[model samples]
Target: MNEDQENDMIQRWVRDTPEEDLKPEDYQHIKTLGSACLTEGNSAQLLTFIQDEKNQGIVKSMGFVLIEPLVNEVVKKEKSLEHCQAAITHLTRVSKLFINHIMRHFFVSSLSSGMTFLLQLDDRKAACVGLVLSALQKQLTRLPVPYTKQLEEADEYGLCRCCTALADFTKSFVQEIKSKNGNYVGTTEDEELRTELLKFCMRSLRELLLDAELSRDRKSSLWLFATEIMVTLPAIQQSLSELLFFNSLKKSIQMDDCQSKESRACLAYLLFVQLITIESFPAVFSPVFVLQCNMEYINQLLSRYAESHLLKGLALYAKSLESVEDNSLPVSLLELQSFYNVPQNLRHILTDCPMQHLRASGLQVFQLFINKLDSEAKHKFFRCMLKTRNHAGVEGYIIKNIKNQVEFSMKPGNASKWFLGVEFLSLLGLVLHLSQGAETDLLNSMDRIMESLNLLRYLLIRDKELRSRTGVWEELCRIKDDYLKMLRVCISLSRAYYSAELKALKDNQKIKAKDQQTDCVLCRYVSQVLHSALVTFDLMESLIVRIEELTEEKLKIPN
Candidate 1:
């Protein structure tokens, strides 16, 4: 129709139709009028009607019928600037209205169906997302305080109502993008749009879904959205499934920054706590591969000092190691040295983590992984770890495990040659002998020093067979004597140095009180280290005298 007829119809509609009595057909006529104004390069008339205060009841009665055309016009590539602005204006006004039940349904339907389709079109996807994201942002002001019950109420802009709609909207496209079961044909442009859409969803996760201020209920809503976005996408599902199921070492993949460390931790938490409980969780492969896929990622999480990241990483590591069988790792796989990576991350938890519970849990998981290996693998790991794990506490932990394994090997009917051979002796030799900087090494590595002494004491008291082996017992004696002589020297040097330092710290008159306070703490730490060294030296001396008595007894027996 011409502009004259359109104006006449608008006048008639305004003049005659009762707001309460207008039929759907009348609303359809309003939509046509709006679309016509859009086509004619001017939407000022409809915008005026929507903007005017007196006509609001009639506009409300029309019930979003005009919005669809305005949305369509706004996304059109050939639309005039005036028309697009008017369309946006009309949308903005309707947005500020009190969203009733009909408007909520319209928004839900739009997100689930109409906008989903619009987001697929290359020509319109950007404008369509811009509009929807704009609407999503507009709802933020009206949202209740985070973690409040008021967020459960229906909102003014229907954001809470459309959460599931948005989630489902994302899920459908992800399935199509990753589906391999059918001869589903799609264009390059369509694929790009689908990929872009999912990227947009990931961006929304960081920007909108992960808002710390969202109520628990709304947070759950966003999580469901995020879950659908992750679970339905083939790449993510396949990546997680392979990690959780397969055994091969896959190449490390770098994810988008949108998959922040927080997002990754959340993903791990969901898998370990929620998804793994279901029988449908893929189990065709082994859990060992899960660690392989996630080893680096888990390390990244565990490497962080944040408790949330640490807890999530620990939980994931425990679950991954749960079903793995002892002695299941092949020699070839062990040779890859990938298993050595765990100790570096575990060091944080085992030695320096501020949280006591986390430290305890970390030690538990560390032993759990250790328990999964066989004697030969354990020996290899110990040898490799001792050489590579530079941290004194971590090295001490490895030494303690070595001692345990040696005791296990000597058990009746459980004999294992891996821990008794020259290789095993050499591993011990590395820790049992003093280096050139013996005093400094002993002072700094009190844990390693103590654990080494304990391991030597255990071997001397229990392993009677070593004396029968050619040169083994004599080499052990030589190393023990050398280690003891160095330990005695270290004890003396440490006591003298720390004592002088403490006396100097106390006697310095010119030191400021704050500076003295800090130095006093340092003095206390040094004193503690010195005390530990002295205790370790006493243990070494007792073990030394016991070894000498054992040697005398062997001499009296005669060969």
Candidate 2:
């Protein structure tokens, strides 16, 4: 047939076919015509046909069919860079148009097959990899926003499917690398391909993470996918080690004049933090991986960017790992020591460069670490807290900070004292945890508890002053009385609870079975700790009552 006649027939087929009615044969026919049109410099008509909303399904299907062959043709011996670029450009456009509907099958087939062909041509691999990443990023940019019910559903399904495809492509690529291993020693071209592939994967995953528009759920799903692939595939480890981790470290160490080195270091740390914090694969990620990655080297990088978000990220990452239930994961004592030092580092950060969010991050990490401590470690950990408390300088920083915040809020015409009161109460609870054993350990624990109670007393006095200034002294006094009553009730309940726990421990210890002694030791220790905690709570409540009464007496005796 003549070219015009053939073009007319293709147009009729596109215009006439109902999307649901089009069979696989019809899809092939459409794909063939589309490829022919591109070859004849008729891409405008092809694009126009594909852009129609009604033809999107068919067009998407045809895209799946056309992508592989076009990529294969570009990587052929007869093809040049221009042909490859043109093919990728066309694929990139198609990807954007139908990205939301692109399935895992399409991604896996095209990427795995296309990468296989492209790996053969060393000179063109970088250009081809760039185009591949560009196209993938464009598709990723079209992921459904996880807002509405329908969109969220679509987002979950699409993200999971895309992740599966990427995982499959990674598996195939890694397999190829393994098969070609040792056949050509120190081949720069092979290294280049490996580097490009790793960059593509890391960049693509990082793009998903850094896209503020993407919902947390979507980002988390992508994170899980990346983590799974990285952990399960051994072949990619070399590239990850060389290109993603060590290369960035090397650049950072050199401290080149260019900002790219710092940028790369930041990206490397970000990716590392993401990998370690994948909640689903806690067991899969061995503690040895952290050691293997050279924690000291990572610490050096962190030190260089001490004031940057890197420290905050590390703090948060440590916090995330604190909740893992499994103890078999290779968290060495050295790693724990490193984590223990976070509060000290944070103290420095707070002293030298105090960013509020970073301080909050540091405090969060400290709190999580304390919560994760075993019975054996509690004493040591508490000693560390005591040292931190002392190193933090003046007393009442928490109370002073809260008072300043309250005063600042009042200036903005926010007279709500209830939230402020509740916040102070919560801070008091954290202080209680910090000084749990203070009654028994007078030198370390009791002093900290006294400091906290003094802080709380100051807060109550400050609150009374603020209420007087706001002309709601009586109302605020009533609220304070009510909160005091609640504290009394809490102390009473804690006393009863601890008493019962102590009795239970005593009863359990009386058991004669040899095996029961070990259990008794644990129970006795827990009961003793509970008794001390209860005493501290009791003392704290009494102090609050006395301070409230004294403040009330002082208020009534106003000049």
The lDDT leader among the candidates is 1
lDDT of model 2 at residue 486?
Answer: 57
TM-scores for all candidates: the values are: 0.64, 0.44
lDDT of 2 by residue, 1-559 (tens): 2358545644655566554565767656656776676676554455455455655545444555656555555565334445545545555565433454456356766777776776667565554655565666556656743334454346654755676566655555566656777654746655655665555554453444332122234455544555544543235334344443355323212234333333333344444454433343324444445433333333433354334334524543463455443222332443465555444555555545546776566555544444444422433343344445553332234433334444544555644343243323333344434323322333234444456556556555555444545444444455455545555565566667677878876666676454544565667678779778777776777787777787766677753
Give the Å shift of residue 441 in candidate 2.
40
The residue-by-residue lDDT of candidate 1 on 1-559, one tens digit each, is: 4558655655666567665566767867767876777677666666766666665655655636666666666556444535555545455456433244333565565455556456456664544654554544344434432233355353444555566666665555555455633466766545554445544544444344433222223445545555564564443233545432342212222235325444444444466544522344555655776666556556656767766567767877887788788656554556543455656678767877788999999988888878888887788777777776467877888899988888887878666666665556778877775554445655557678778878887877765766656677677778777777776776667666766765675565236464654555666676676566656656656766766676566657644
CA lDDT of every candidate? 0.60, 0.50
Write down the worst ten-residue block by lDDT for model 2: 249-258
Name the top TM-score candidate: 1
